[model samples]
Target: MLHQEKISVRQFTILVFMYTLGTSVIYLPSLVASYGKENGWISVLGSSLIGFGVVFILNKIAQLDEKKHLFELLEFIFGKWIGRIISVLILMFVIYLLATNLRQIGDFITTQVMVQTPIYVIMIIFILVSLFAVKLGLEVIGRTSEIFFPYALFSLILLIVLVAPQADFSNIQPLFRENIAGAFLAVFPASEVPYFQLFVFLAIFPSVNKPDKAKKGFYIGVALGSFILFIITFMALMVLGPDFTARNQYPTYILGKKISIAEFIERIEILVAIAWFFSIFFKLTINFYALSLGVSYLLKLKSVQTLTTPIAFFVVILGIILFPNIIYFMDFSQFYWPFFAITFGLFIPLLMLLIGMIKKRKQGNGSQTPS
Candidate 1:
């Protein structure tokens, strides 16, 4: 039997916001700064505009079949053979994402928070938490996200307010010096890795009880999350300077470190770390959940929960070996991740939508012309 669980619009909106904040807040400032320099925030804006377009496309695809989830719609839109091929490929990408997120959190903890702890231990603990969430199903994940949203939002607001003292608007000088091309070039990486990757949400959107509200919620969530990123990117440029921001692996963390209010309130970078952990945890859970669902759908299994353990194990193993080092990982994210994201996130979905539309039009004409 298909899972009958559903989440409210509010829950879905919270999930979308939390999911967007998950990895982008941790990595985007540095990456965008590196490409757009002093005007890096401008690049972020450009990327966000593209992100909105991607969301529009995704929303239309979701509306194409209110009753079918993304995986089911695949076979409906295409045909059995082609749809299965696409479904398998998407499943592989989803698993790869789970592994990447697992590795990312592990790397962040081992490098920034606890230099002495083993990375595998960190990965296992994170995986277990995500596994629990995935097993609980989408409604539970939605509720968990709703519960944590306020804390995460507060932490983010506090980080911004507290760090305001260190900001130097002069650091963002000569804003348009990079010209449109420079900013446009930065958009591919900045937006694709973070915002466009939201295509993954397609697999989960059908879980929403109010499908009509999904489009509105998605735009609101993406807009809000991108605005937060905009603020962080601008702040990083102003406080850390573009050159320094570009060079750092995690500029938001560095921004948190710069917080000092009369020397009495210091070392509150932990707040940023905490918020990042909360967001990333949800992100990992959602992706893992999607992966389990895909596996069950592909293998014709009855329950997604059964596949969770083996999938978690495989993810942990992949996370352990996926990246040889931090440099190579960051390099891949910069040069390679956008293309990978676009291929699955944008290209495949758009193609499916196009084909579905053509098929629908033909069927309508055929019925109208019946003898």
Candidate 2:
């Protein structure tokens, strides 16, 4: 297969942050609040720590196999049969994540903004756009993120500023009253998913222009993205308070709705929606690229482009099946999926890193000459 072109370290970081932030920014506060209540922000902080650790594990693996993607590294570490099996599992998990994210975006748009539009229409449009982006390959997606990420960040800052008038500092009061366990539990879904999802970026790490900078870029992106999410969560809580933020499905959207510049410039929710759509667009593109790359590697295809359409179609179908309704998606994500994601994204990569290191050491020790 023709290799994808390399992307700059800046572009790589943008791709990681934009993909990680995405649609989660809209609904995450509510999900976190569900588990955390007044302690939701704590969950956000806790999740950031978990995410940092996951990035460290992934970076170690990337450093060890600077010239290869995760699939090749797995093959080298475990041999073909077992490696391919593990790759298949990872591929399936990625596909599921892509579908879930796409469906959530589609559902969000339909439910909140375009009640009349069919959800399938939104899903198909995004899938097709993502397919086109994937066909263009990783460079294009990375560059696209570099462009959109700034606007996304700007929109976030704008929302926070606009909502400042409504924020009540007392909303998040009684801090640490929930104890350590409650704080950790709240962080489970909020920070974990955003930070851990970067694992899939392993597919593109080999294509980074400065491979050594991958770790720095990855962590910077995560820290910056988490800080943004944290601020958003804080603003949402401060503005809406726990009771309201918890009940609202999209606290960020509501924050936008509450923004009023002299009362004449109200109803700026459209701006917020546009920013969110762009964020989710980059996100879906990256996920689609990863899925295409994984399939191409598994089948040993001459080009990753060939799998784009097939996978896009499958994603649309999967989006429809995997989320019959928003509630089901929310329940699965909050209650069950975070643990599964932790296992696949964090624990498994750490295990591979340890095993790869030990195997390399043993081989090194055994290969010494008679000297």
Candidate 3:
């Protein structure tokens, strides 16, 4: 059966905020710095505006029929066959997205923390935790986000403040080092992972108990997410320099390592790691929930939570097989994934909005016609 669960506006806001931070906090600095160099901050500022537009488009699509979600609207607007085909494509993309994220956490833990532990072992543990959340449904997920959000926010803020003294403003000077075009180029890679990938929220929008407040919350969440991204990017460049930031896979983690206040408080990269874990955990939970829920809706299943186990098994396999190593993953993300993301993130939702508007106009004309 379709779920009747509802999350408060506050819960929804936190979900969006945490979701926007997602995997971007740790990896985006390197990704953007590699392209924009000292101008990575510029790219972040530019892309966040695009992110706002994207949120507007996604919300418009979701609002087309307040009661029907993205999946049902696909069928309603496109007819059964085309809609189902599109649904299958989106669902497949979600699966891959989930696997990519799972693989990221897996690689991070194995390489950085667990050392000798095999990657798959880490993947299994993380996926199982997310799968447990998926089984519990979005209400639990939203509530959990609320509980952890305060700590995540506080810890992240502490990290930034502690590292602030290390920042060398000179490192960010000579702005637009790559000229305007290169900085603009950086925005593309910077935009894809965090902003475009947020199409997942379209599926969850209808679950918010307060639609009006949730709309405001969506804008707030995106703005806050983009701001945090900018601060982290700017800080990374100033403290570590663009080369160091770009070269290091997890520059934010290194910023944590740089924290030495009187040498009394040191090696607190754990704070960054812990805060990241909360964001990624929620990210994985939301992605997995979307995957399982999308599958249930596509198959016309009665219950949304039924497919968590079997689907997660495939994700674990793909999480391992899809990414051979960090090099391949980074290259794919920079070179190909941005375009891959917009296909769903921008074009699909834009298509939905246009088609939905057209349909509404036609219906209005039909209603006015004499019987």
Clash number for candidate 3: 2
lDDT of 1 by residue, 35-86 (tens): 7788888888998899898899889899888767778889989899899999
In terms of lDDT, the poorest run of 10 residues in model 2 is 178-187
lDDT of 2 at 151: 82
**Which of 2 and 3 is the better model by lDDT?**
3
Model 3 gets an lDDT of 0.87
After superposition, the stretches of candidate 2 with alpha carbons farther than 4 Å from their true spots are 1-4, 178-180
Of candidates 3 and 2, the better by TM-score: 3
Which pairs clash inside model 2? 1-302, 43-187
Error of 1 at 234 (Å): 0.7
Q: In lDDT terms, how accurate is model 1? A: 0.87
How are the candidates ranked when ordered by TM-score, highest leading? 3, 1, 2
Question: Which of 1 and 2 is the better model by TM-score?
Answer: 1
Q: Which ten residues in a row have the lowest lDDT in candidate 3?
A: 175-184
Please list the residue runs of candidate 3 whose C-alpha ends up more than 4 Å from where it truly belongs after superposition: 177-179
Q: Return the TM-score for candidate 2, rounded to 2 decimals.
A: 0.96
- lDDT by residue (314-335, candidate 2, tens digit) is 8889889886776787788878
Q: Candidate 3 has what TM-score? A: 0.98
